[model samples]
Target: MHEDEWGEPGGGAPSEEHRDRHELSPHQGSGEQEIEASLRPRKLDDFVGQPRVREQLQLVLHGALGRGEQPDHVLFAGPPGLGKTSLAMILASELSASIRVTSGPALERPGDLAAMLSNLAPGDVLFIDEIHRMARPAEEMLYLAMEDYRVDVVVGKGPGATSIPLDIAPFTLVGATTRSGSLTGPLRDRFGFTAHMEFYDSSELSEVIRRSARILGVDLREDGAEEISRRCRGTPRIANRLLRRVRDYAEVRSDGAVTREVARAALEVYDVDELGLDRLDRAVLGALARFFNGGPVGISTLAVAVGEEQTTIEEVCEPYLVRVGMLARTPRGRVATAAAWRHLGLVPPEHAVGAGTGVVVDTEPSLFEE
Candidate 1:
């Protein structure tokens, strides 16, 4: 999923070696990376939010450490920017092991995964982000490696192929995916622990903003932090990004002091409204409410109307919109909820699907209905 970019902290261009070509980070640059890394909590105790996840992880890590063995295969399923990456790093730190970071899309061939697996030291943490996207062959190879710590390396083709079992180090696997439902049953079952990351509440997000502001040395007031947090869509990454933008505006527009009014003004300039909806978000809602008259329109049609990719609208924008009760996915198509129309300052048609009636009205005309 693509996230909005904040202004690059350092002027240097992004380094290809440090990031995947397929994946897009919020901000990029060796210097910018360092700044982001600095903001991440190094220890489990230092991590904020997800109280249940933090406690469960501590128990798992401690139990393994006490037994003098590697921990079980862990799976983190959640939306982007809820600290899945951070928790993986923290797990490694807690175990005092080195972490090898890679993503599923990068492991196209079994050989690619094999090479990485072979090089891992015992007790190392192998973090595979977007694990659901891994190639089928590599994923099959991983099954054995994850279960038995051995991989069958095929040395030839067809009838001449010979499977050679190679033993790998006893390491831990940490797989993260935004779409847990896409994971195969066998793969999901292999994980000893699976943590689902939830969206933060306003209070939690406000705490995140305050913590981030301190780390970045921004002169922020509580009200300013709360304002930014409320508009961040319950994501810490967005909160940090918005905080930086507000800080920039405060420095140039005022005296480097971030207050509630300053934050509102900055977000207005950036086109983020109080409900955390941006231009694209509003565009989607507007198209549904105006063009389709609160549609049961197909996602494809909506994408064309908004000039956005189907995946972008489906993955990035739709989740929050649906969570906020502004959108609904129906068997027929996508429909705008009554709350959506009201949010856009438009009235919902009485015959609309989500017009606060118990029944669904077909907005589209039927040829048979004379």
Candidate 2:
């Protein structure tokens, strides 16, 4: 479904002005928590798309069950909101194993991870979200735990220390990260299998919308779901969010039925245009077009130009822009592609003289040289 729709009250019941006011706010750390709570997939079957990953995971779980052993460590890498956490939970459920969930940062010291490992029962799953952020000491402990089911804890500091070898129960470790490349090679290689998740296709997102709608008990027409899915940026989370908004639109504005017209109206009211570009998206493009003269601008410069955070520009906006071919990354920085210029109804200078164009111009000589 549409990115703007999720967690909205069903039916277009909210006043246009109210909706507009809400849409104008930033979508950073605030709204996402609510959206995530509302839309997280509760079951494996409900997790849309990533069929290959699903198949492989099912086999792993099944084999583990058949052999009465803990499944091997699994590493899931992808952009955010791709169901890595949900899949981890499902794996734990399938194995009927207790899951201890924590982020990399939570386990600050080797002792912290060692304690957690020591407490785990056999076949339990330890899910580490944002594993790339784990401290070096904790990561070192994890390597031994994963490889040999043991942790060596130093009893005291400095030269007086003696190492204590503590055995831990055989447990499965599931790691999730947005940037797998940042993980050390040793850490990366420790996982028995790595699953790289990709964005959902429109069809997959539509199914996600339909499924969510069914669960939420909203009457969503097929075309309406499809329309929302098309603008969901190939993300299941966005699709679920869009469904909620469209449902609100349908209920408040018209009959409590989500139709294509209702979906379009809801998205328009939310400042989500036809190309799935929200207000922030358009603002980024506008900044690149107007300020930088179709930008070969650095990310920080672009963020400053747009009055948005650099991380927001780089993570939330830039990836989609680059994916849709509206932006390109160059050795120098981010450059607005021709498509970006056209999308903003602007034209690049005919002879903009980009770096490495090999065109030379006369320059003034220094007085000392003369």
Candidate 3:
């Protein structure tokens, strides 16, 4: 049997080392992947949030089952930590089919993708995460496989190579991407159905935390669940991660009961604020408000001020900041809103973008917009 990405044997239980490592830090490092997998809902009904997507997907899967055929290629696009990967697994489970998991980065060559396609059995589910990042050649090869269930296998070198058309087993392709816009139009169009995952609301995340608490055997009070949910940044993955951290603190610092007080104390120690703004998040806000004077500053300048990579500033910090009305993107550059100043306990300058209204009017496209 082949090894999974975590080095665990495929189709088998995780190794003892994985268990021990998970015990050590249930929410940190690569071990978190294993824990998250365990926490994922095996059935679609058990999955939290994105009700529209769930309803749409149920019909597709049921219709395909009635026809006794594999469902069409499905695409899941949204921000990370919203159960894309989990949904892919659930699709396989619903069909009672085997699933093979790989990421776009893993399929960098046409041959690499060809090998994966050739190995799939009929009705198998091939899940490719971060599909937008797949190599150009691999992506082109996939177009043919997705439409015709055939791949051109070239033998020998370059000009002397012979292109052999190999018919592969018909399988369902499930693609997940955080940046669907980066995907080619042809690739996007090929997907028979697309599910856009949304950020979990407070109530949904509280339910998620409760479910996870039961699974982890944590003595989490309702208030504790609510507290953790509020600070989880609207993502189930983050909710589970924070719950594990809170559990650790409860076991060590108290009688192991996670109440509101305990959760707050634990989060305070970990530097997560009321709005779920962590160290980096606050740092970005502080820099924007204090250093750049509620800036229309370029991302490079802001990144330098915060000593972070531009990509980190753009992808990680900017999205949430923009979402919560603390920042804005414009033709000029990034601008901190009036809320950012207030959050940092500073007064916004009169020249600030949203200073007059005290509300950030985002002219640029929102990160949460579908």
* Best candidate, TM-score: 1
Using TM-score as the yardstick, the better of models 2 and 3 is: 3
Please give the ranking of all candidate structures by lDDT, highest first, separated by commas.
Answer: 1, 3, 2
Ten contiguous residues with the weakest lDDT in model 3: 1-10
Cα-based lDDT at residue 104, candidate 2: 83
For every model shown, the clashing-pair count is 0, 17, 0
Residue 97 lDDT in candidate 2: 82
lDDT of 1 by residue, 1-370 (tens): 1122211111112221112123436655455667677788888998879999999989999998999888999999887778888899899999999999988878899999999999999999999988988889999999999999999999999999999999999999999987799999999999999999988888988888888889889999999988998898887778877888899999999989999999999999989999999888899999999998887788899999999778778866888899999988876678898889989998877866567677775555445321
At residue 146, candidate 1 shows an lDDT of 97
CA shift of 217, model 3, Å: 0.4
**Positional deviation of 163 in candidate 2, in angstroms?**
1.8
Q: What is the C-alpha lDDT of each candidate?
A: 0.83, 0.76, 0.82
For candidate 1, give the lDDT of residue 318.
86
Q: Give the higher-lDDT candidate: 1 or 3.
A: 1
Report the error of model 3 at residue 300, Å: 0.7
lDDT of 2: 0.76
lDDT score, residue 201, model 2? 88
Clashes of 3: 0
TM-score of 1: 0.90
